[model samples]
Structures are given as C-alpha cells and as structure tokens.
Target chain A: MPLRRWSAAAAPLAGSPGTKQIVVARENWRARAQEIAAAGGRLMALWASGPAATGRPAPRTLYAAFVLPPGLLVLTMPDDLAHDEYPGIEEVFPHASRMQRALFDVSGWRSSDPDVRPWLRHAAWPADFHPLIHETAPTAAEEPRPDDYAFVRVEGEGVHEIAVGPVHAGIIEPGHFRFSVVGEKVLKLEERLGYAHKGVERRFTELPILEGHRLAARLCGDSTVTYAWAYCQALEGLAGTPIPARAAWLRALALELERAANHLGDLGALGNDAGFAFGLSQFSLLKEQLLRATHAAFGQRYLLDFVVPGGTRADLAPEGARALSDCAGHLAQQTRVLRGIYDEHAGLRDRFAGAGMVTPALAARLGLTGLVGRASGQAHDLRSDAPWAPYDELAPGKAGATEGDVAARVAVRFDELFESCRLIGRIVRDLPGGTHLAAGLPTPPEGALGIGLIEGWRGPVMIALEAGASGSIRRCHPHDPSWQNWPVLEHAIIGNIVPDFPLINKSFNLAYSGHDL
Target chain B: MWKTLRQIARTGIVTQPPPTGDGSLRLREALQADIREILGRALCIRVVDSGSCNGCELEIQALNNPVYNLEGLGIRFVASPRHADLLLVTGPVARNMDVALRRTWDAMPDPKLVLATGDCAATGGIFGETYATRGRLASVIPVDIVVPGCPPAPERILAGILAAIRASHAHPRSR
Candidate 1:
C-alpha cells in the first residue's frame, strides 16, 4: 500500500479506518503533502470550505484529500483571511495550480503558487469579492466586463496563435482553446474553461441536504447517474442510512446503462471525427436505441435526477428489468460486430494510432485517473480498487493499453462498453428483492462530514458533504475527474496537428461544466 | 464499404414516421409550412448553448440521428449564424457566455428566429439567476418560442424551432 508513518502532529487524524479527517498545522501541511507525494499518494481533491456556522470568527479551513489505496486521507489547515495565503502544493502536484486558483477565486484564500491567474473567476464579479465567503451575498451583480485571460506565450519563428471559443460550432458545452501553432503542428495548447460555471457550489448551500442530490445530478448531465449516486452515497454515509440491496443493485444498473450509452455515443463521434460518417450513422442509431431502452427502464432517457439521497427516487420494474436485459443482450451482439468493423477499418486505424499520445510517465506525473488513465497504462478503477456494495460482488474487469494514443482510448472504451453490458446482465439476473427506497433519512449530527467516491463513466466522481444543523448543507464539493484529465489534454495536443486537436480532445472527452462547477 | 452497403440494404430505412397526421402532426405541418413559406425551401438553423448542462445538447444531437433524421424535413444545422435562419438556444445565460451568446444572435442574418430549448433556457431551470448566471434566454436576447422540459425531447425541440419560424413569419420585423 506504500503507507508511510505519520508525524506526531498528524497522529490525531489517523483514527478511523475507511475515511479519516485530520487537521494539520499550517506550518506542517506542506511537509505532510510532500511526504504523501513521496509515498506515491495521488492528490484526489483540494478545496477550501466556507466559514464555520458557529459564528465564532474561526479561520476558513483548506482541505486536501489524498488517495491511499483502500481509503482516502483528508488533511485540513486553517486559512485566516487576515493572512489570506496558504502554502501551495503545486510544487508537489502540478495539477493543484488550477485548483488552488479556483480556491483563491471563490474563497479568498490565496496559494503561494507563482501562477496567480484567475481560474473560475473571469471578472464577472469584482476582484475583491470572493463568492464562497459568507459576507459576499449571492445578489451582487456587476456590469459585464471583457475578460483578458493571459495565455502563456510560446514566442519564436512562425509561432502563430489560433483562438477557439467559449461557444463552439457544435452543440457541446462552452470552453475556449488557444493553440500556438507553427503551420499545421501545434507548439502548445492552453484551454480556458469555466464558461459554464453556474455557481453550483453556492447553490448547494441554498438547498436542503436531502434536495442537494438533484443539483448534484445536474452537475454534469452526461454522468448524472454517477454524480447522483455519489451524492447519495455521501449523504447516506453522513446520515448513517443503510440503503437496501435492491436499491444498490438498481443504482449499479442505472450507472452501467449510462456508461453504455455514453460509450456508444463517443464511439460514433470518434469515428466521425476520423472521417467515417457511416460509423457515425450506425453508432448514433445504436446509441439512440440504448437511450430509448434507458427511458423505458428509468422513465428518463438520460436518467437525470433519478438517483436521490437515502436511495434512488425510483426502482426498475420487472418489465423494465426485462427490457433492459433484452437491450443489453442485443447491444452486446451489435457492438461486437461494430467493434470488428472499427478494428479492421484501415483508414480509422491510421488516424487513431500513434496520434495524441500521452506517455505513461506523463500520465502518472499528471495523476490522470479514470478511463483516460487506464488507456495510458494507469489501471485504477474504483469499482475494483475500492469496491462498495454491488461492485464488491460483481468483480468487473479493468481495461487498459500501453499504446496511450487515440486508438488505445477507443479500445479502452470498447472494452469498457462490453464489460458494462456484462455487469448490467449480472445485475439484472441477480436482482435483489426488497424495498427500493430507504424508509426515512435521519439527519446527521451537526458538523458531520462524509465523502462519497464513485467511478463514473468518465472517471471517479467524488462528493464531499458537510452537514449543518437541522438538515442543511454547510458545504458540498463535487469534484469531477475532468479536473485532472483537462490539463492532460493540453499536454496531449503538443505535437499533434491543429486539425487533429478535436479528435484528440474527443478521445479524452473531459467535461467542461463538470470542471467549471 | 460493400459490407456497409449490404448491411444498409438488409436494414432498409429505419427512420420514424414524420410528425404528420398524428396529435403533433398539425403543429409540425404548420411549422414546416411556415418555414417553407419564409425561406422558400430548406430552413437553415444554428444552435447556441448559452450555458447548459449538455442534457439539452444530447437531445438536440439526437434530432440528427437516423430515427429523427431532421435533415430530411428540410431543416439543417448550419455552421455559421450568418447563413442560419433560426437560432436554437439552450441553457440559462451564464454571465461569462453572455457576450458570446449575444454575438451569435447578432451574427445571424436577418429574418432569423430564436427558439429557447429546455427549462433552463425558458426560465433558468435549477440554476436560476445567480452571480455567475443571467437567468433565462429572454433576459439576454429576444426569444420567439420556448420548449420547456428539464431537457425537452427532440420532437418538442423540433416543434419549438418550427414555432419560432412561424412567429418570425407572423411578426416579419422580429429579425
């Protein structure tokens, strides 16, 4: 497990087994982070919590979670606005740069990192105003100002820049891409996201703890089931509510369906990007059929807001289960045939192989998780690695490839799609018999904290929930896997041509709204 | 390619029946007729996502799939708004995307109709007007028609687009 000895100061936080909340002094926090990094620990999530609810003028705490195999280790340190700065872990973890910037923008806690550029804050509000601070009201509205984000320049001969959009030609989410290119080859690529930031974190504080799952479901529409399940898992963990076996199985079913639908859609899109329009038509047809089956089973095509706290909002009826099983069987056969076509297509292979390669070393350094990580030879799946409930029993296979190119990612997706179909069949076949929803959700004691981590179709979606008095949420941070993978996209696009940017970008397919929120 | 052709021959056409002679047929026909009357042939549409969850975008994308085959109805999505006759906008207007959305609306040629798709575009949905959001599509620009659902179905979005075209024809000065 590569577990290291904790210093005497960090001894108090090592109390519990599954998840532990530890407080570290500001002085020792950086040293602890460095030690964890040295011990092969990956930075899972880092965010600043809002002010304490007791109104005792306490310093706002900065929390950083590290993945230590079977469990998560969360370290916290107080950040006083008077001092207004904390040690930056970007030196230890490079990806922490943007996360630290986001924390500073939202919570007024600055990091010592040299890159002090605004991340989520794009001059929509005044520079002084921090949205997460309780003093800053949600009603404050400033006149829209034009934002001039500084893109790190790559100056030399023939280093011309091409700027893309916060709004694109396709009906996808909004994000800007700046490519420094010499002719067709890209010298560097910088992505400016957060155009879809809807103040979801602040909105979470406004909603009741029970109702926050709905908002979580909308955090990223494509991975609604995964997000909602993670949120529910966190809420249930905090409340000490035990979900029924049947409900857990149903959640797994919905999640696997979501995975299958997205994979089908992406497979088609990737093929289309590679200039195979026939694949697009066929795969889109299959995806549509899968979505129809999902609608028949869950009453919603996308299964948005279906998984709520305590348990799921609805259960799969017998007929729905039968329909899902039938669809899975049919999709399995059809996808197998299509997979053969995709593999044999020489043109597709040529475009996909050896393009947008992110070497395994770079992937490990960047701490890329989920399917993208798997494609690049980093095999870490929460279902297998940190199993809970249904997955603990199912024992799903983890897909990977050493090639680490666009083709490897596509192969991983195909492998995952087939595996997800099998998991769905297993879930349906051994469907438990019980009440789908928990009887009642008990409110957790005030100041209680719980973490929910679930492997979404994209990757691990983590939700950290802090319960307030009388069923209110003090703070909730839904960390999407996109946070780690988005930066990898910039690295992956370095040597690729400007034309292949979209193809490479689609291979990673990181969520803009998910990260923005 | 030959295998693909053989598979196509075996499958034949799998497109669903057009919205005609059913409960939604009248609405669909009226919309198609109005769009035809205004443009004289195909309706050129441009989709703008002001700030959405991409749930609505998925449904919008579905309209192009074989089953829906939206292009067969003489409605096609154009790359640029300058060539588009209709602008289909989704999501609440995020403050960051406010300028881009307005620019997109401005870029569309004259006689353009705007359709706000989904509950968020209609009334900002769950992510209401906040520090980062401008609320509904109407708050940012003029919306001729609205399709309201968490994410309105593809058929409903098609209806909304048609209605917007119809409204544009009725007003004539909306563009």
Candidate 2:
C-alpha cells in the first residue's frame, strides 16, 4: 500500500519542490490515499470527468489532489472497472468527505465510505438522471421531484434548527446552511450547497478549444485572472508551447493587481463588518481606483479576458504603466495610513480580536492555505511555493501571521497589498519588450495530462487538464481553495454571536460557485 | 473630519461622478440611435444567471444601488418570461445549468434580446470550458451584446445595460 516506502537515496527526485512524486499501484489506491493522509497530505478535491461532458460516457476518470506542506500531490483513477468504493480518507481528514460524495454523484462511481448524501445534485432534475454518464437513454421528461435531505439530527432540550439560504436578505450567492443551536449558542452548523449549481462539468464537452477559456475565466469571477491563467497553463503545457516572456510578465502583473484590488476591498469589508466604516470607505475607494487603473491598462476592469490560451490580449501602454505606478504609489501610502487607523481603533479592535478565530493548530490540521491560511499561521503561497512563470525569477516569499483572528486576516490582506504593489512596480520596471501573445496553439499530443497551479485572490487554484488527440478537451478538474476553506468557516463561527456571522464569513470570503462547479 | 479631508486631498481623487442619465454624450447618441431605430417605449427585461459567483448579481441588484438608480432608465429585470422583452444572463452556464439555461430561454417570449453580462457570460470569459462548463452564452443561447469583464465595473455594467437596451430597440425580433 505504501508502495515501497520512499528510500532516503531517492529523496532528491522524490522531494523536489517544483513537483513531488508519490507512487501508488492501481489496486491499492485507497490504501495509498490512507498513507497520504497518515503522512499529513490533506485531500483537497475530487472530480470525475471523461471524453464527453454529456451524452454517451467513455471511461470515467476520477482525479483527486492532496495538499502537502511542500506543495500538492495528485492521483488519477480510470474508473472503468468495477472496484470496491475506496475507503474515504475523511477519518484522517474531514475535508475529503464532500469530495468523495461529489465523485460518486458526478461519475456513477460509488464511495465505500458510509457518509453519503447528494453533494451538488439538487432535485431540479430527476433522481435517476445522472448527467455525467456518457450514454443517455431516451425517456419522457418527468416532473421534478422534491428532495428530502436528511441532515444529521441533534436531540437536546431547547435545541432548535435555524435554516438560512441558498437565498438570503443580503446580496450573496445561494447556499443553504442549517445551524443547530441552543438559544444563542451554535451547537452544530451543516451546509447544503450547489443551489446555484450550473452543471459546469457537463458543459465542457460542448465547447470547442478556442471558446473554452471563456468558461474557465468565469469559474470564480473574483479569481478570474488566476482561473484563466491556470486554464491557459494547462493548455500551453499540453501543447508544449511557451508563452512570450512579455505576455507572461503581463499576466503576472494582472494577477498581482487583482490580488491588491481584492485584498483592499476585503480588508475594508472585514473592517466594516467589525463596525469600522472608515476602513470600508478607504479600502473600497482604493479598490475602485485600482480597478480604474486596470481598466485603463486592460480595457475593462476586474481584469477579465486579459488572459487567453496562448497569452494575454491587451498590452500595457507607456502612459498606462505610469498611471498604474502612480495609483500603486497612492495606494501604498494610504494603506500605511489606514493601517494606523485599524491598529488603534478600540471599538473595531474589540469586535475583531479573538472573534471567529482559527487557531494555528487547527489551521495546520485543516491544511488551510492562501491568505486565510497565512493569517492563521499556515504559511503557504503558490507564488512562493510553486514558483511558476515570472514568480521563479521574482521568488516572492509567503506572507503569514500567527494570530488567526479577524485582525490577522485584515493584517494578511494589508501585507499582501503592499507585496502586490511592490511586485507590480518591479514588473513594470523590468517590463520585457516582446510580443503579448504567441502564435496559434499547436494541436495536443494523443494523450497528455498537464497540471496548472495558480494563486488566485482567494487561494491556490489547481487545474488538471487531460487532452485527447486533435486538440479537444478530454477531462479537466478545476479545484478552488474554497473547498478546503469553507468548512473552516463553520469551525470559526463556533462560540461567536449569530449577528457576527457576516463579518467572519466575509473575512474568509470563499467562493461557493467555484467549489460547487 | 480633518483627516478625511486630508485623505481625500492627498489622494487628489473624488467620489465617482454623480449618476448621469446617459453615461456620456456619444453613449447617449448610441441610446438615441437605438431608440430611433426601434422605439422609445418601455422594454421588459429578463435576468438569467448563466453561472457567476453572484458578485455581478450584487452590483446588478445595486442597479437599485441608490446612487446608480437603474430603474430610472426603464431597465427592468422581470421575473417571468411572458413579460420579458430581453434576456440578461450571468455566470458561465455550468454543466448542470445547461438544461435550466435552455429552458429559461424557451420560457422567454419571442422578439427578446439576449444580453450576456460579465466576462464569464460573454465568451465563457474566465470560467472557461472545463468539465464543468457547457460553453459561452453564445454557444448555447443566442447573445446580442457581449459585456466583457470578470465582473464589469458598475459604470461599465450600466453602460452594458444601456447598450443592451439600445440593441433591443434597434433590432426588435432579431433574436
């Protein structure tokens, strides 16, 4: 099962940072997964895909990625033969439960682990209708069936269930969370997502190559630049094509700008949620200004459509660079000023301190990464850890803090904002003079598996793309960091008053649609 | 208050300009041209979320954002298809969302305009076709105006709204 415990002599090849190799036999996947769990690699995501998105199914491919300290590890299963459902790694890692269920729902594959309920399949469609199945039998459409989701029951005196959205009063995505509470104390919180399930996985087969990037970029709009870059990386990797150096730098610039913009906005919103309106006003204004500069440079704001398969679409002009530099200068200055305000404000401090805290110990156990993880002391940034593209030359280090409270989250954002500002400035100063994009993407080899790991504003976004012959997409698994972080929100909300949920939730700001997809 | 003033002055920037009926004069002319080609009457709009994180939904909801005041433009997002004159969809239309998306399109009355807002909806902008996506909005449903951006700025969103309204007027029954 352990696949002949990795020898000390093989450490060089086994432990290389760019990629880590873990060998597992086809028969002992479940056991190897357990070994991965025992070795502290948290299973982050599970997805199933094949040649076609919908219609006659081919061999179902199940791919799962594990998060290790040094980097990430991925395992693939053909899902073509009948095998016992692999043992769920949830006992060692609670996060793998949902992913196991998702694999079951997406592919007709079953998980032996008992913990099972529908993951993303809402009752809007029939129960028997498995959209991911390759072959479809013709039948008359039946009326949609109502669902009876059996949530875990907790029996106690004065313990009641509080159900809130897939729909809510405030503007947010649709996700139903059931909290079992005793008076004001939350005893348990359970989530039912996929309310906004758009069946993104099934639609991939319907898209041509050139048009696929459009869907990839929107996987999580907030992380548009990251998602697009990851998809392109996979495509380019498959084609064995190198994007122009200038295009690569431009992509990194756009990514960092996006990081800065989101961090500013989130820090302000986190502050606002903690009764600090000034933080909100200042950060929102800064984000708006940053977005305006992005628009000037990239034609539209929020940095969408800026990255294509081969390279970027828009090239930065000279005046645009100056304007961006000017904006960064102003932002960096204001960030310092606001940091003083945030640090000194007592009322804001009272609400933020020790509230919705994710202890460093728990954070590491959960394998939390990205800004939230950094705030909690699990220091890992893909930019530094993975070091892809310009990042290798730049060698940016991960930013982190030990205090895993709302304050730490805010501080993490602040630190990242300055880092982004510096990186953007460096990119502009070291602007490569070359074409923005490479020529046509070459056809892919017969069968190739390419993985792309990008640091989105949210966290590390891992996309594994398997391409068939003639440049068509065979299987793609786009994993959002939210899959690992959303569960942590439930843990963070414990013992906190109900009203402060928004503050805590916003601090994490995980994307539901991205994970659901 | 002094600090606030100093901050504003130091940045040398002001709040976004007050809401103008037509974003700019040329934009207004585009609107007028749309009206002239079609009609100046009120048009019913249909809102569809092709597949987005719902951030755009927030800003779109902010069309009622108190300041941007979208209803003033006669831009309405109708609930049912019988009343809708145009369709505005968001997100990248995830795999599971395809059937619903097609059904939503079918529900709309004929002579309806399709406005794909957000980069995701426009060309499958960011949420590119993975195992999770069907394709761009145009690949599945007919699209008229493609508003490109991850989540377009509110001003650009408003511009897109105006453009969609104009397109609907200019080419009635075209879709």
- Taken in order, the candidates have interface RMSDs of 1.6, 5.8
On lDDT, the leading prediction is 1
Residue-level lDDT tens digits of model 2 in B1-175: 4565576566553433323223231223433454424534456666766557765764565454334445555666666666777677777765555655676678777666677777677766544654445548787776666666556657766666565444334322122
CAPRI band for model 2: incorrect
Using DockQ as the measure, the top candidate is: 1
Error of 1 at A237 (Å): 0.7
For candidate 1, list the clashing residue pairs, or say none.
none
Candidates in order, TM-scores: namely 0.94, 0.81
Candidate 2 regions exceeding 4 Å error are A1-17, A20-23, A51-58, A69-71, A78-84, A135-146, B1-13, B16-51, B55-152, B159-175
Task: Let me know the DockQ for model 1.
Answer: 0.59
> Which stretch of 10 consecutive residues in model 1 chain A shows the poorest summed lDDT?
A8-17
- Residues A1-517 of candidate 2 have per-residue lDDT tens digits of 2523541112211111344434434576677677777776667667766645443436656666776656666666665366656545666667777777777766656776687787877655555556566445224233323446888887999989888755344445656788888888777788887755655565555566555677677667678888888888877876778889999999999999989977887887788788776666677777777877887877776666789978898999998998888888888988998887778778878888887899999997777767899999887777877677789897775678999988788888888889889888889889899899998988766456666778887888877776654656666677889888887888998888777778888899888778887
Q: What is the C-alpha lDDT profile of model 1 across A1-517, one tens digit per residue?
A: 1235453333312111256667887888788888888877889899888673222233478999888677678898876456557899998888899999998887788889999999998867777777677555445454466678999999999899999988787778899999999999999999999898888888887788899999998888899999899888888887877789988998999999999999999999999999998788888898888888888887888888888766778888888888888989988988887888888899999999999999999999998889999999989998988888888899999999978999999999999999999998899999899888888888877677788888999998888888877888888898999999999999999888998988998899889888998
Second chain TM-score per prediction? Answer: 0.82, 0.71
